[model samples]
Target: MEIRDLTPAERRVWRAFPRGRRVDFTDRPPGPERTVRAKVLRALLLTQGAADGEVASLRMTAARITGRLDLKYATVEHPVSLHGCHFDEVPFLYGARVRQFNLQGSHLPGLDAATIHVDGVLRVTGCRVTGLARLGGARISGALFCDGAEFGSPGVATALELNHVSVGRDLYGVGLAAHGTVRLNGAEVTGKVNLRDAVLDAPGGTALNAKLLTVGSNVSLDELQAQGEVRLHGARIPGQLGLTGARLSEPGGTALDVGAVVIGSGADLTGLQAEGRIELHDATVTGPLDLSRARLTAPGGVVLDATSLTVGSNVVLHRLQAEGRVELRGATISGQLNCAGARFTNPGETALRASSCTIGELWLREDSLIEGAVNLRRSQIDMVHAEPGAWPDVVKLDGFVYTALNPRRPARERLPLLERDDDGYVPFAYEQLAASYRRIGDEAGVRAVQLARQRRHRGTLPWYARIWGYLQEVTVGYGFKPLRAAAWLVALLAAGTAAFGLHHPPPLKPDETPGFNALFYTLDLLLPIIDFGQEKAFKPQGGYQWLSYALILAGWVLATTIITGITRALSRQ
Candidate 1:
């Protein structure tokens, strides 16, 4: 359009475009004087105007732009800055290439910048859009700023879509308020994606869907308040994915889903408050996963499901409060799994299910509270640092193996933990406890645990087998206390000697009999294998004969039990 056809606002913008001067119409009233035709603005951006030595840009503020800024498939050389401007319709810039696109504080119905390429930053800071802001498949050489921007109203399907978009620098959405889903699925950001203090409300639907998103640096969602599910499933972040102080609520459903994601620097979810389940299944984190002081509540369901999650470093869950089950089953942690001051509460079910987990060290300190059971079945942990009080009423330790135990308490204190296994009489649990004691050279603890194991095994045996087990325990303490066998032998010998000494027996044959001494006679009768010929030579009649018979039977009983107990003990060693 010519200068004669341009409105007063457009005339000012037209005259200022060559010199890159900003036309401020904030003082103008709402009339034709403050209105600029979109075609005039687009014409100035597309045409080359000669200037002295200044860069040409279409910069205008507080102007009402009428008609669509149709720049589809067009390449504009100059930059565009329309701050605090109001658009009559959505600007159609599909597949267009521009230097820099700045619409900061602009009020638009929506934006259609799909497949567009911007050489410099795209600033939409503090803008309000009542419809969808579609920027899918766009490529920005610089950062994409959307700080304090409001997108769509309530009940919208999608407020802002950046699917498959690529940003060379950071994507800032600090304090951004989106009423529907803000999708960044398959987007690639060379720098960080900062959505700190942002509020996303899409009740009963997804709030942020960033599946398969790849970020070169950190993705900060700290202090973000999301009403629906925030899915980052399959997203790959080279730096930390921080959600500290974030509040996510999606009751009876998933609040945060980061399944199968690969995080290079790990995740920081400290001080997070999530009402529904937070899934991290099959995720891999290179650095530490710090969830300290996070509160996750999903009663009767899983609050945090991190099954098969692999962390290169520590998983710090200190002071974490979880109302439902926290599943770490099949997880592999290279460093310590610290639950120092965490509280897990799931009344009738497993509060923490860590079955099949491979952990370097598991720290369950005295301050940790588990109201329900803890299932550690089939887990292989290098070391465990747990206080006696940290164990819950029921613990499933069958097939659980640990190389070392901290505080190295006596078996009396530690044995109770093994006994509390929900599956009654698990021999492996007792054996593992004994092995832990043996590694620390606690011989007494080993004996105690072994003896407890035998006792527990006795209860599961048949009635006749239990009887024999009881006899072994009473006489030799299941071979753990060898001195008890000797004591019984000495007591039986004294009684046999006294009974025969008081009543001398008659000889079977006078010529064949040797001189009968009380001690030798008793020894000959009580010892089964060794014979001193006193039993063949002597004939003890009536009550005295019965005394000799009783001595013989007692000897066989003691001899059989001692040999069996010794063999069992040797096999264990």
Candidate 2:
């Protein structure tokens, strides 16, 4: 910090700036105007070693500069530092070449650093800018810090705009309190963008408009409180985008709109609380997304709409208490989508609509309470780790193809999940469940699911269709229990044989038939498809003919039910 001796004109301007005591004070006392003009100011600075220029770097305290510090389109080679200063008018440093821009603890009306390139850090720590701090197209070779700074006044306008700016190192803005929006659109940062403990408010507008921002490392907005929306649409972050303990409050509008944003690492949005909807439509994350303990509310409407979103790793939503609907349609997760210990409440309407989604595995087992229906139609998951009693009542599993289902209950209790709703209990649902059983080598469970499907299928049919399914299920277990029908047939055969043996039917043609064996006669009438020739030759008279007619009808019913059972068994195999 080798501050050169000031000239008569430079010393006059230095006296106007706040002294060492004023640096700690919050308020600035009035001072005289600057006496050094642009020509004299440039000549005194810009020292080229020792011989070319005799002046040292311009390191001054309390630099209350007047007039527009217009260094635009100029080359400032010397290191300039002016701390604890107050500006009469905003500086115009666009397209200027400065070694460094350290204006910490300064009070400026505005800043227009567009296209200005700084070799060293651009620090404005603890400064209070009353107007816009525009840095569009400005390139900084080192870090850009605004820690403990306040930007913008009270209104719905852009407080800190960094559009198209390129920073070589980190951009730290911790404890930054922006009254209006903070736009970082089209900005590029090689290091992390840490905005931890920042407060950005814009009433009913965007709070942090970070569209198209390309960051090489993480973008942490931890413990941030935004009164309006936080838009990250079209940003490309190569590392994690953490929003741990953040709160976004925007009533009807979207709170966090992150559509089409690409994050190379996971988004750790743990403990995030949003009043409005959080939309992540079409976003691509290459790592795990943990939303554990987050409370996203949009009661009676969609809370989190993540349609077509792609996650490379798992999405952990453990203990997340969400209200309203969560639509994850067409999402593709390479890892598990765990929602254990989570609660989703949206009565009647869909609580979780994950239709056409694909996941490596699903965990919705213990302590998971979803009040509304869960529609996972056409979704494909490798396995489902669920508890039968803890799962939602109405789960739409039509076309939900999963390889395995591990439930903490017996097959009897778990099979009822497929039969709870007739509308969702389609043929594909049964086949999908059967496939899951087959994966675990549970042959009995597979047939049990198929039987339960028939039961549900019977309930959804017309009276005649119901009767047909009922007969098949009761007699043969809808081809699942073929031996059951065999046992019933044997009982009927013995009963019919004894009835005709004691009181034999008088034969119509005595010479056409031999000795009437009652057992053979009963067998002939018991089978509708096969005739043993005993029924055609014999003729029963009076009440005996009624017994013969009843047996013929029973044979037809038994034959059709048996054929149905065989067809179903073959189709399932």
Candidate 3:
């Protein structure tokens, strides 16, 4: 760049500029002031011709321009550059058309540039606006840069609003500070919306509301400090939505509400420290949603409400220390949901409710402590890699299905998670266990799990029903043990014959007892519908009567158990 110093003739134009008869400002004796009204300046700019080349360094400072500065509903062909200037009142450029606008290091009470169309970059770097800066519905052909500007008036609702504005290139406000709300709702930016190292404070409500905003590249709020909520609902971000070291604190309210937003890449909140609820409900991310080492705290409420969120890749929540509930109910993650060393501290309220979620792989190992219920009902997962003591006590496993549960523990240790109380011993729970065992190719183990579930279910019944359950299980293994049923019948027959042969008691009436064909006589006593006429003929005097009664009881037990077991197998098929 070549040096283009201000010429002597241009200095004369600056020294001879007239102060207007305005009420907001009065010059010091009007000796050498650069005060001009909008009309006269517009006329002078029109006659510039070739003199515009000499005035490229047309910079002014501490000169207050008089009048309303109304450029609203007008069209000017020339580009304007104002530096270090002071506006007597709020400048109104709403609905105006200008080639380019460069206003840097200026102090203004306000700016109304709503619906204005700028042909090139609109740079307002290092300026301070003490009131509302309304640029809503504005259209800029190039970028808008406000690198170190300060905006907002104290006790106001919104300070900077760009609602429905469209920018052709990037919008940079890297070091901007706003004391009230900064509304970018429905705004469309072709490039990134960079707000890195910004400080926004709106204690009454939302500090930054960018609902329905569209950004082509990353929306950088990294290291942003906000006292109120930051709402980015329904915004479409094609790149990373970076919030790496942001501190958002709204106490008992929402701190970051980005629900229904779609990200082409991912949301990087690697070290986010939020005090209130951070909702990402129904959002979709194509890349990994990183929350590693995040510290989110909302005492009894939800710390992170990401319910129904869909992530194309992994959800990395390792080492997260969330104080309240972290819900992922109905969410779908194509990759794993990792919680290796995370600690959740909301008891009685579900700390991590991932019910009905379809996750590729789940890792809750390495002492990840969730103090409340983990509702995984109807969720379909590839595998759950967990340690022995990693499961919470009140786990809601009703219809929670997984292909394989790689609990790296002994069977005795892992089985307790399957059959614990507070919702225990359902048939689906047995099915889940059987499926897990089958994934490991353990058919015997699968049958053992099914049998264990039946036993625990039997324990839940009344004493009479429990007796029937025990008889069915021990005698025939509830239709799952046919060999055991055959063995039991053989043992009973052998014992009955031996008892009859050993104690050859005579009949109560003289010569009334049947002849001792022990095999045929034992069959008559033990068979349910046999007609050997032993019970009719035998009137035993001593211990034979008691032995006959015991054999008949055993016969009924075995016969009923076998029939019931057969019915169960057929019904299952």
User: Which candidate leads the pack in lDDT?
Assistant: 1
Expressed as tens digits, the lDDT of each residue in 1-573 for candidate 1 is 688987767778988999999999999999898998888877888875749998889888999999999999899889899999999999999999999999999999999999999999999999999899999999999999999999989878999999999999999999999999999999999999999999999988999999999999999999999999999999999999999999999999999999999999889999999999999999999999999999999999999999999999999999999999999999999999999999999999999999999999999988899999999999999999998888999999989999999977878998888788899999999888888888878888999998999999999999999998898888888778878878987887898788878888999999878998888888888789988888888889998888889888877777777787788677767
Judge candidate 2 at residue 475 and give its lDDT.
Answer: 76
Model 1 TM-score, 2 decimals: 0.97
In order of listing, the candidates' clash counts read: 0, 2, 0
Residue 71 lDDT in model 2?
79
lDDT of each: 0.93, 0.82, 0.81
**TM-score to native of every candidate shown:** 0.97, 0.91, 0.86
> Residue 86 of candidate 1: its Cα lDDT?
98
Estimate the lDDT of model 1: 0.93
Among all windows of ten consecutive residues in candidate 2, which has the lowest summed lDDT?
17-26
User: For candidate 1, what is the total of clashing residue pairs?
Assistant: 0
Residue 522, model 2: lDDT of: 87
Model 3 residue 211 CA deviation (Å) reads: 0.8
